[model samples]
Target chain A: MSATLAVAAAQAKTKTSNYARIYWPFVVPAGLLVFAIIIAPWVFTLIMSVHEWKVGEDPAFVGLENYIRLFNDSRFQWAILRTVYFTTLAVLFPMVLGIAAAVCFHKNFPFRGLARTIFILPMMATPVAVALVWTMMFHPQLGVLNYLLTSIGLPASEWSYNAVSVIPTLVLVETWQWTPLVMLIVLGGLASLPQDPYEAAKLDGASSWQMFRHITLPLVWPHIIVALVIRTIDALKAFDTIFVISNGGPGTASETLNIFLYQTAFAYYNMGYASAITVVFFILIMLVSLVLFSARQKTTFQ
Target chain B: MKMRGLPGKIGFALSVFALISPAILVFLWMLSLAFKNEVDNTAFPPVFIPNPPTLDNFRAVFEKNNFFHYAWNSIIVSFTATGLALLLGVPAGFGIAKSKASKAAALIMIARVTPGLSYLIPLFLIFQWLGLTGTLTPIIITHLVITVPIVVWVMIGFFEGLPAELEEAALVDGATIWQAFRFVALPLARPGVTVAMILSFIFSWNNFIFGVVLAGRTTRTLPVAVYNVLTFEQISWGPLAAAALLVTAPVLLLTLLMQKEIVAGLTAGGVKGG
Candidate 1:
């Protein structure tokens, strides 16, 4: 009896080891990749942010001087304001338009599927390609946008060429590209909603708008929140379209933090300042994400 | 109830048409530009249709620029990054799902949420130090930053959705965990794999910033090549449109072919958007 008990214990030990073998081998690569690729570099970024170094030069420890300079810099302040303004528009337009589009597409209309497919085309198309097409369209004299404006008895304005209108114009391009994403997410939520409420509301003489406001809106609020967070984060880091179209041009009009960071790092060779910008940019994104995520949790529970 | 028949249908259809026309018109304009001559493309009225659609823009794209070479580079970078991401992420996803390792999964999510520029700066310095810039190797590696999280995230959702009883039964029958995963879970996760693969490929293909910073002139991807055309060449709308269309064509084709899977993959998780 004792011998048999000992043998059983040995077998259990082997089994546990076998499980560990499979688990470790399977999970280690991903952990290692994330560490090497993401966490390590970010740590390096944090360290570099405190130093003063240009490209091809030895680093010197500066200890928050870059951050100090950033605080006092008017251009940095403008970038912060512009990023907020751009993100607000980019998120606002898409959420409103996408929810509206989703509601419209949710109905039993003809060619709804076809219309949706076309709408999402802009979303799926490469960003650089999208920017180039829009750049051509935004041309002051030769572009079709101006041509359309004149034909419609409206004035032709310098789209991205003028400093004052550049952020809005860039946001317009962003809205064109991302509205479909919001629409798709909301459509998913709409499809899965319980039909009992809508059916009961109709019987009780609620108008369609009333039903949408009372039932549909509350139900899909979580989805709208999710879309809001995603769009906000993306718009904050929007690089390709802005970089390709304006390159933070017309004398620093549309230079969001991402654009400024790129120019600082690559174009100007200011590595230390760029790293500082990266750290701040990362914190801003995290703060926004935290707020939205907490909001998501609240709505999701409700 | 008042407007319930043919008139309602017509009105609904018109509304839908008006809504989708902007989306359609953008593509149509690009198409017209690609097919029109330089004179027709730049006309103030903007020729809506090419009288005779010309392939000359495409010809110019290939001849004047090394368009084919950049396209090849893009293909290689996207394919390899996607392939490596799958190899690394699938089993990891399965392990996390089975073990309920939420911490590891969250670690990977941090990778996704952080800005790409943060990664780019340090990686750029490291690569320059290692003499690895200007090679497809660095570009492909950097793309993993985009691709791996996507694969891991999607696969986690899929693997968790899978029935656990099958793997347990396999384990109870004396099959090891690896065998169970290889034979049972992986096969069950085929649709997930397909979705992950397609989404990662589309994303890696569309990525521009990594290539912009890392690639040499000869190693440029199609998007970078298009950017060069815009910046360097005189603003010839036809060739510019043609170049843009070429960069977009492969992704556009993928979207059309596997749109259902793409949508599923996209909506599968919300960690990575844009």
Candidate 2:
């Protein structure tokens, strides 16, 4: 009996070990590729940030100079401020609009599914494509927006050309493109909500506003926070659309940190300065994410 | 909860329309503009109805531009990247899931969050060193950065949700581990695979940043090609809109057709519902 039991245990171990061994070869190459492509680049960026180099020039060590210079750079400051401004507007508008849309579409009605699909179209469309479309739409002359304004007897404005208007217009474009993503996240939250509290609220003769304020708000708070955080990070690192639409615009008026960094690195071949900007950008994103995560934890715990 | 009745129904319809009309209006305007002629496109009143609708813009896109080449490039890059991502990601996901490697997944997310350009510059250097710059190979490999994590993260949830009993049973039937996974595990994970495929395709197809930086004239994807028209043209609204629409139309159609599938794909593992 003892001998038989030992043999069975050995057989089981051999079978499980064989399975593990078979899968390891497949896992390593793919796993390494991800690590190489994704993780390695960030490390490379960090190393490159400290080294003073132009394209085709040997990188020289410039300890803390890039970092020090970043603090005093007015353009970098402006880019940071502009990024914050854009992120603030982008986050705030989308949160309000997304929540409103989610609330409106939370229940079954005619074309709710179709409405949801239409809403998400912007999210699915290429950022560059959307930027192109909006560029034409927001044209100062011969564009639909100006055309509409003039037809309605309001004076037409140069939306994209004006320095002050450029950032806001970019913000508007970002809002249009991304509000649907926030809406979708919140919609998922709303749909997953238990029906009992809502039923109880109705039984107590609560108004829709009251129910939303007291019940729905608290329940979907996590989703709201997630959407905000994700959108914040995305807005902070806003590129592609802004790049295509404005190319940092009529005299760097619409430049964000990413564009700033891109120009600093690729266009100017100032890798050290770009790297310094990137490190700062990375910190900003991490800080925002940390705050949001902590806030979410507190809300969920409560 | 019970339905609120007639007044409620009326209010709901109005609210829904109000919520969705802006997006619908924008799309409709784009569609109309795409079909309008140059004369009507910039008409003073901004013609909503293209009275003499024409396919001139699309024709212009096809005739003057290398639309077919760009489209083919996009298709090959997106599919190849997605395909490679799947081959790599599924196993990684299974391994990560089985090992419960949340840290590995978080590391992948960090990569996802970092702006593509940060890496693109250095990668460009590397590609140049390898003499592979301006090739589809670099784009496909770079796109894996976008596609792989999405596949792995999504599939992690899928693998976790799956029952282990079937695989165990296959093992009990004296099949090798590879055989069990090949014949049993993968076939059962069709939904997850589909979700991965759709998302990977969308992301890969719509990727503009990589194409812009990496692609040469001969190797340009649709977005890059469309962008070229914008820079190259003398700000001609008609052809530009036409070109933009032509580039966007296939994606738009694919999106509409796969709306249900795409939604399911995106929201999968993130949320729980059908």
Candidate 3:
């Protein structure tokens, strides 16, 4: 009621008053929607994490047992380690390839725009769709990949089907899809870069490679960092490709944290345990994001 | 980022082709698979292009599945969600920009930055309780979790870039705050609106996780439909690639055509709305 009166007063005063006074009217809907969808679910996850809950039954209070069990669960531990491993592999290829692509594209060229437009097609393609296409291509016997391998005098190996190779194989798919995204971001940075330093380096008779290493690399470092941060966050939350490709694999080999939490809740119906995983996983992501965000703040985008 | 002369041009061309071929090869492979018969798809050396190209796979995609219904569902859910996001998000973005509310902007960031699965289970349960599962409503509403942030953040950038003097002049003309915003600020942010709409629509259309969890069979969106095609007992590469291609066709065309706008939106948002 008081809020209603305030809104009315703000409206009446709107003709002569400050615009900032009406902040709530503009801000609150998005806030409320976010709260209802993201925040409320988050709080509910917190509550559910502490209880022994499953589908078709009431949640029983379990306190720290779920968290304790999660720590002791070797599979959960493996998921964490595997998630980190996957994130590293996923980010590394994309970063190196993307940066190289950006640098290569940064030079003057014909059909540059058309080539770039084609390059980013993989990134823009639907993730699930991309996974499916790659899954066919990854088939051991009938697939193009093995055919190509034999053509090149290499042995055909089971790709995502092999437990040991699942994560790396999935990372290959990920790199295929997202390297273009990193290229695009880095290219944007490369485009905006001031030319004066390069001119100075040229005047000083610096070699091309030296100009790149000393001049170009330093200026574009911030953009590279931004791409790293973005890719890190993205790679950590990766699901669609991994899910469709391995479905956590021949065993639990490719089951990253996201997949683990998902199966725990949906497949196993261990809601409380899944919720516990959710909290831990969410916190883990938040911590990584926070670290990157702070690092980003120190670099750029402030 | 520009260069001169023949050597530089040749070096650039080689690098560009080497960098770009992986992407082109995969897409071309998908196209080939979509056109090939199942026998040819599994042939020892994969056919680079289908010799007798067939529309049979495309036919199977439409016939074996309710593809058009799912496409319609995708359209309805994304359109409604993107519309609602714009309605709520633009003003919030403007307010956040004008008020210098980094916390609020960060709050929206928190919504999107969290993993989708973290919220999916609970939202699924809530929707079940509300008896809104098996419908488009939940999918549309839940998509706002991600879409609103994209719109709000992108629009905030656009609003920040708009000249303040234009709005100040409107204010000085005895225009109300609402008038100044509706007449002066919003019109100038047209490009931002387009970016927001294209981005939100594309993301919502392509969203797999939310559609997987919340949507029923009839209500399944394109990604979910394509996923269902994959789970069928025998793996038919022809039908599978065809389904995937059909699902991605609209978004791909949009991205290919509006390359500049998408690039601007991407660099500004600095996050994957794809």
Per-residue CA lDDT of candidate 1, range B51-77, in tens?
Answer: 999999999888898888998999999
The CAPRI quality class of candidate 2 comes to medium
Please report the TM-score between candidate 3 and the true structure. 0.94
Identify the candidate with maximal lDDT: 1
Winner of 1 and 2 under lDDT: 1
What CA RMSD would you report for each candidate? 2.7, 3.2, 4.3
**Tens-place lDDT digits, model 2, residues B218-267:** 88988888887555753666677777776677777877887877776665
User: What range of 10 consecutive residues in model 3 chain A has the weakest lDDT sum?
Assistant: A15-24
Query: How high is the CA lDDT of each candidate model?
Result: 0.87, 0.80, 0.86
Error of 2 at B199 (Å): 1.0
Candidate 3: TM-score of chain A is 0.90
Which candidate ranks first by DockQ, i.e. highest? 3
Backbone collisions counted per model = 0, 0, 0
lDDT of the structure predicted as candidate 2: 0.80
Off by over 4 Å in 1: A1-24, A299-302, B1-8, B271-274
lDDT of 3 by residue, B1-274 (tens): 4456889778777778888888888888889999988888878767777989999999987887788888899889899999999999999999888877888888887766678888888988898888998888998888887789999999999999998999899988999778988999999999999998888888887789888777786888889888875567447789999999888888899999998888888877775642
DockQ of each model vs. true complex: 0.61, 0.53, 0.65
Per-model chain A TM = 0.91, 0.90, 0.90
